[model samples]
Target: MVVNTGKTFDPQRMLGTMRLADVDRGTDASGNHLIRIAGKPVRWALGCNFDVWPWACPATASSDAVRFGGDIAQLTDPTDTSIGMYVGTNAYYNGIFFEEQPDGSHALTTDIAAPHYYADGSTVITGSIRFRVSYDLMRTDMGIPNPETLTSTSLAGAVKTPTGAPAAGKFVTWHDPDGGGFFIEASGFTFSRKRLLVDAARITPTRPALARTVRKTARRGVLVHTRALPRGARVTSYAAYCRSASGHVVRASGAPGSSVVVVTGLRRGRSYRLQGGRELQGRPRCVERAAHPARPSLTLRPRAVPAARPAPASRGRPRGWRSTPHGRCATPTPCGWRTRSRDSRMVLNDSSA
Candidate 1:
């Protein structure tokens, strides 16, 4: 009879009629036969050549009168009847064994750590085991400074000034961060940004026509005539000196449109010549003789005039020298007339003589 044990079962047609008496059966003369059964193709009986233990027999052995109800069959362990065993291959046991930890964590046999059993009969698995399909790690470090902070002051000690009084319509000093320290200028004076690096005491205004004449007189140790000066002009002082006739060796004081500077030290009643420009109208001539007989007559005559010497032809300035209209030389040379040309040369003649 077929027993339905709630599992799939297919019996061989040829073996369906086999009875207990038809199959070979053997037993140990003293006790039961030993039999070990696994999920192999051939069925084995106790005392068979393939049986591992001849004294024990599988519970499913025919002689044991074991009948499976359906496709499933449960067998009791020969050593311990309390435990049940199922017959299957690798496919059944591959996912079967597992352990749970005290923290309710579970692991399989393939896990890194072995499954553990607790005193409370609970099983646990410990240790970390990573199964990563993909992993990536990144790190970055940088250094940056504050944008609003000022680092240094390089122009701390710089100075600047106007070489003289700022003239009308011209910037006394040009725009420069380092000042005009190294700049050599033509007309204007050079200065730094905040103060003058060089002394500007020698710089003066352009000489006016009136100042020219008085300057010549002061050089001769004579009283310069300043009555015809501009109304607001002041006579500062007069400077004078004595030199051989025809020789123009002298120094003068007084600035344009200012006071005449007079020099004190001089010998009285000595024949002397007087010369002046816009402030005075006269040529250099000897003073009138003195009146006292005891004193030698200080007779002043027109100083012996020296013949004009022709200027030597200039070798011409080097290539880069600047030519200026004011008859002064400046670097980074300027362009202007060098000498009087034959066409523009003038000759003076006495018409009334």
Candidate 2:
């Protein structure tokens, strides 16, 4: 993590570099035009420093400066070495989070405690290390506050697919509850629906229980199902199987426990799966939720909109013009998405009024 003490760093003392996204408060949803509110600031716009390196202030540093450029091999004390880093990645972010405090300012916070491990063999902490970075559109002090020490824990685990086959090829990565369990992302931002996990096709290759589609359809919609889950538990990967009325089979599956599956490309029927489960994050673990026999089946169907009725021919007026309630002309043109009133002339919009 990077911190600036409202001071400037000698450019010659900077060693490496760092990067961060611009700070954004929000936007005015309604206005004559889209007006960016608060606005985003450079990572170190208020002060400077990245990681352990010193930073130059805006007055002396380049425009909207962020990182520092100093030599690490040589230090002021001739004992310590290295400097400059404004970002940290050891702690897997559960999701991009931002919040507003009682003071009317926004705070970006998370609960991932990552221990500091140095490759230079200089430092090792078996205890917990917490991280916190605050942002304020009004604050003039060092924008990013330093991280603090807090209650912490050590995390590690292992996951094996099966004796005969394997689920994924990548390393058995253990993502903190925020890092997404091994392969599946259980926590963070979950939309109403999920990507297609069950494969929709005539032939089922991976497993025999998974059904296949008999026919295909044009448009597709999502099918959703929800069940009670423990706090912090999320759906990582899932499989879906579907069948037609005549016993024809169709299937869909993606990335592990995808909540939603594409049931299109097949005739109007239903996709049925005997069982499915979500992969929960935390320590390396194998999901047994979708492999049970007593589990309930899920069904998804797409709702298609009927075609629109044809508009009647113009009432004896110009080909492109139509009579408006006022003594004005109207045309069906897909241009702007707003309507406003001038001094004497007003635009007739079917959407607004």
lDDT of 2: 0.27
lDDT of 1: 0.22
Poorest lDDT segment (10 consecutive residues) of candidate 1: 133-142
Candidate 1 lDDT over 111-197, as tens digits, reads 011112222224221111111000010000000011011112100111222333332111122111222111111112221111112
Using lDDT as the measure, the top candidate is: 2
TM-score of each: 0.14, 0.21
Top candidate when judged by TM-score against the true structure: 2
Evaluated at residue 137, the lDDT of candidate 1 is 6
Residue-by-residue lDDT tens digits, candidate 2, 22-112? 1111123332212111112222222223332121212222222333331222235422211111122222223223344343323333222
Clash count, candidate 2: 38
- The regions of model 1 sitting more than 4 angstroms off are 1-203, 208-258, 263-353
